[model samples]
Target chain A: MAARKPIIGVMGPGRTEVHTEPVDKHVELALELGKQIAAHGWLLLTGGRNIGVMDAACRGAKSAGGTTIGILPGPDAMDISDAVDIPILTGLGSARDNINALSASVLVAVGMGPGTAAEVALALKARKPVVLLATNPEAEKFFSGLAPGLLHVAGDVEGAVTHVKGLLAAQQGGAAGGAEQQQQ
Target chain B: MAARKPIIGVMGPGRTEVHTEPVDKHVELALELGKQIAAHGWLLLTGGRNIGVMDAACRGAKSAGGTTIGILPGPDAMDISDAVDIPILTGLGSARDNINALSASVLVAVGMGPGTAAEVALALKARKPVVLLATNPEAEKFFSGLAPGLLHVAGDVEGAVTHVKGLLAAQQGGAAGGAEQQQQ
Candidate 1:
């Protein structure tokens, strides 16, 4: 289950067409984000596709020999990224976005699109912290307003990772405090 | 695995406090909606809690002698509704809402809240038709805008069931057309 280390969900937009694949700044950021997540000994969870941010992040994690879990939308490995170490075929379509949101202790979104936006919303609805990396200003503002302090806008990949760390630490601290209060 | 009949997810707000349980008009609508879904031989699914719309709908389904699946947030049956024939303990907290959204062939939300809003959003994002019985106007507008044709507003429980039937028929027709085109 790879529950040993904390899991960080890196969700973003994915393109199906090879020609439309924008290997731009966002893709670069996603790749670096995966490396940083792996370097910190955290598991990387993604949408598990062969193109766009999902593929780039998974490949980056694999390049560093880090574990990756890709929750695919379909119930097969037809479009799974080779870099994904564990591919879960849900057959639930985009609804699996909930699993991606809940499975991670903290979510780090590299870019914004309908898919990533849904994941971000689901994460926030579940009361999980989300670090948005270079997403558009509109999406940034919209999602941030949804859950207040649950949203963190990071300037870059490292900043996103840092936000992830801070958020996870805060959550753990809150959980511990709650446990203590319960005992009292 | 009750796949013989399509499953309809009935989601709405739930409260932990027994005294705060709102057995109001929305609860009545949800119960009637569940009965309508069962009368059509469709399976019903919910959050599987002891309070709120989830409990009311499941109880309604059981009164009609219909099978109900409850995807509980916790990993145990500590607060599961006795009316749920099958309980899926995900322990994913509110994240299980995604499964509720994905598992159902169609989603019928009788009221609106943060939890139900998330389910409605996820269902729309997945391109599934959702029938809103008596949700708020703001939620109705926001979710309807998210997916142009997927959001169906119904005035009452019977109207909601009618919308569900119409949407499912349209979906099947579209699928059939797509399959015919593929064959051609």
Candidate 2:
């Protein structure tokens, strides 16, 4: 394995606690995405909390032996999930640069809201690849008539992994050829 | 004012220190989203940094009289933009839950990386309206062929905002008088 893995961004909902009602499906989906990131030798980056999908994805990534990075907002916050490999406490001051936590090659968006969507655009501007899983009606409709080859829509974790693997293979091939040409 | 302003999430590249590099377009985009959020009475959420898109978004939101929130991720992190009203310092030791920074009704995605995508998925699971700007080949393929009306795909920030506004109007109208009448 390489010394570093790809950083995979997972976008979703915050303040999920307000929902009051539990959405069990999110946990499963989050875990699925986490597992995909881990299996593909990618790092998982998120908001660094223990509740809702954040906890689930962290657990999933850990179970798959992937390194998970947590970017916290302050020093006095509550405990994060047990899966975190790096706990970066930026204090209450650096709350806006969480996107910098993971310099990723690709980003996979799972269940998301406005906050999540903002991150999607952030990744795009950074020239990172982003994948969407289990999207909502609004997202689906908004993206209608878009080219499929560019977006990479996956409904499940397995598909997400496969899609990423394909992308990685292409990247590796390009790198290998360039290295060989340089040596020659 | 409407019961709720469509929340906009801003994510993008951030530098630890002010650099001599030319300003990026993301700065203007983030600020625009923030202004629209405030003008529409929607909340603005960000990573709470003083530079980059985070700072720009705060400026726009504040200028437009919007509600701005910032969530810092680390112990040594700097303070949020002056425009931020709610500064949440989540000292959780993970980067996976930054999405928790805001509970948005509508998500407008901006420039970011993998961490940003993670937030997008969380929002999807939460079933919030999503508007994605800057569709590339990867993103286009990642979100292709999904059910209509789930994702709102836009080519730029302006398009994204327009899409979200459409969603907000529909949602508000539905909430006003629907199968189940409720207030946003």
Candidate 3:
């Protein structure tokens, strides 16, 4: 059987005024991050909306031949973008953010907003690692005081991916050590 | 054969240090709001955690013999407070905020934080009436410039309840007028 790919969750704004421009830097960054995550032989998960950062990320992942999943807030497929390979129509609404937090081994926050902030908080509460790609000043300030081990702030997509890979390696090492201890 | 009762969603802090006091004013206020909502023959809904405003509101509603539904973030009933008569384990995590927003005709925001702010935004996006209790200065500032028709800022529990009742009446009136027009 093929090894199960690691799932990396992406959290960001669903709507933003920056989207009015022909090119949004945040979206571009998120797209590059998604591509990097996919290129690393991992699955990408997002809020699954057709607009904003989520859409850009999914699009990037698909462009790199990577699998992507969208955990939608509503039951209808109307809001989901074509970039998603699998659409989990939760019908649970924004509360589905919990699933997004819990389903991934690590979460990448591309931009800060109320929704994205909530996702980051939930990931922290769940004891999952969060990589903040700080594009927004408010989001950066929000996590400035957080304890260092679980949360890592990166200036760009490459820096964020490096952190994610390190965390994943550490997680595997811990799990293997635990297994050996159990055997002994 | 009876009419369906309106569901009023109460959004607030799930975890608070303010809970340590002999009597948390915020909790007390939430409790009173719950009682008022129940006394008005409405059903009350909350996030269903054992701490903070969600607990207080559920307790208040239960005290007044009001039916209370808790939309929990996880599948387990372990975190659900006894104040809730019905607990829905969505396991959707923070994403469940969308459910909390859409399940109610109107939502009362008791406090402001990332989670509560997300709820307020979802309610606004869904075009649902949102009553801000103005307990959190940041939350108040966030909604200060919102259009005045569906969003209302209330100074106290009584004021919040009054606004909710007025919105309910307006909604019913609008529905009735539409029905009358259809009959014509």
Candidate 4:
């Protein structure tokens, strides 16, 4: 029997709390990433927040009529995106980054920040592949050096989605991250 | 009533899976960090693994007759440290770093690695202070730049414990990470 639908985690910055303004490029990239993830018939996962990459991605996925699962930082539904169909509240605050990173078959980071970097690092630690989009060259270099095979730099959303598919296929072809595969 | 005893989480490389040989300095520092955390009348926390930093820290805490907790990556009691008084099986694999980062009053990273970097990043994302010991300068600079005042570079285990105490005091005095404070 086939395993459940692969959960693709989209991790990025939530500028509502950190930055005064939304990062337009990240929002744009994340929106496309969500659309691509949904178009592929994969499960889309993101942080259930009101603004920034999470909200934009959720919007894109919902626009495509795809189901989305959001991991909320607070216990109550404080600032969740309206598009999230399934909201998982951990009340773990920033530590909730772990849930976002661990739950995904592959994590696509559209932007770089303290939280997003943590998720990427955690995912790599579990031997999971992380596809980068719209992130700086410095971050790309640093993370790439840390995990040679697991880090993939993508030029755009389509490139990211392609790498995601390739990485997941690679995982299936080989017995990599035996414990991480059980996350779904 | 006052809050429960503060938990100091010790995070580092497991080494058994990733590396063949142990980094001696990290093991030595983590052992002392655990002892200092225990002696300060605070609780000790670590990954419930049999080798490397987790095991060494647990051993130090137990040696000092202190209460210790472990976050196990698997559901079953596999590769658990003998010194772990309370073992929480997460089955989260590398994502278990969130529990280690969030559950602590402060996290002391004895060494630098993919897993430890993620924990430090997660903790800082949640506005928790992290004390560093025996880590390379590049890792230190990277994390410090991300968190600013949240990062503390320690010369020794005793120094790390001091920073942990100071940071916790600052948290209580100020309203930093209000949501994170509710983690315990």
Q: What tier of docking accuracy does candidate 3 attain?
A: incorrect
* DockQ, all candidates in order: 0.21, 0.08, 0.22, 0.47
What is each candidate's fraction of native interface contacts (fnat)?
0.24, 0.05, 0.29, 0.65
Which of candidates 2 and 4 is the stronger one according to TM-score? 4
Best by TM-score: 4
State each candidate's chain A TM-score. 0.91, 0.76, 0.91, 0.89
- In the range B111-158, model 2's lDDT, one tens digit per residue, is 544444545544554456666666355444444323235566777767
> What TM-score did chain B of candidate 3 earn?
0.91
- Off by more than 4 A, model 2: A1-184, B1-6, B15-20, B75-79, B93-102, B144-148, B178-184
Task: Estimate every model's Cα lDDT from 0 to 1.
Answer: 0.81, 0.63, 0.82, 0.84
Candidate structures ordered by TM-score, highest first: 4, 3, 1, 2
TM-score of 2: 0.49
DockQ comparison, 2 vs 4, better candidate: 4
The Cα error of candidate 4 at residue B64, in Å, is 4.0
DockQ of 2: 0.08
* Candidate 2 per-residue C-alpha lDDT over A27-134 given as tens digits, one digit per residue, 9 for 90 to 100: 678888898788877888876666666677888899998888876655755766667778766664233333542355666677755545545544543445667788
Preferred candidate (lDDT higher): 2 or 4? 4
Q: Write the per-residue lDDT of candidate 3 for residues A1-184, one digit (tens) a residue.
A: 9667899999898884325777777798888988998899999999998888899999999999999999998988888978999999998766778789899999999876656766776676666899989645444544443334687889999999999999999988888677765465
lDDT of 4 at B81: 90
- Model 3, position A121, has a per-residue lDDT of 66
Error of 2 at A156 (Å): 16
**Candidate 2 chain A lDDT trough over 10 residues, lowest sum:** A141-150
Candidate 4 deviant stretches above 4 angstroms: A1-6, A17-23, A39-41, A64-67, A74-78, A86-96, A172-184, B1-5, B16-23, B39-41, B75-77, B88-96, B168-184
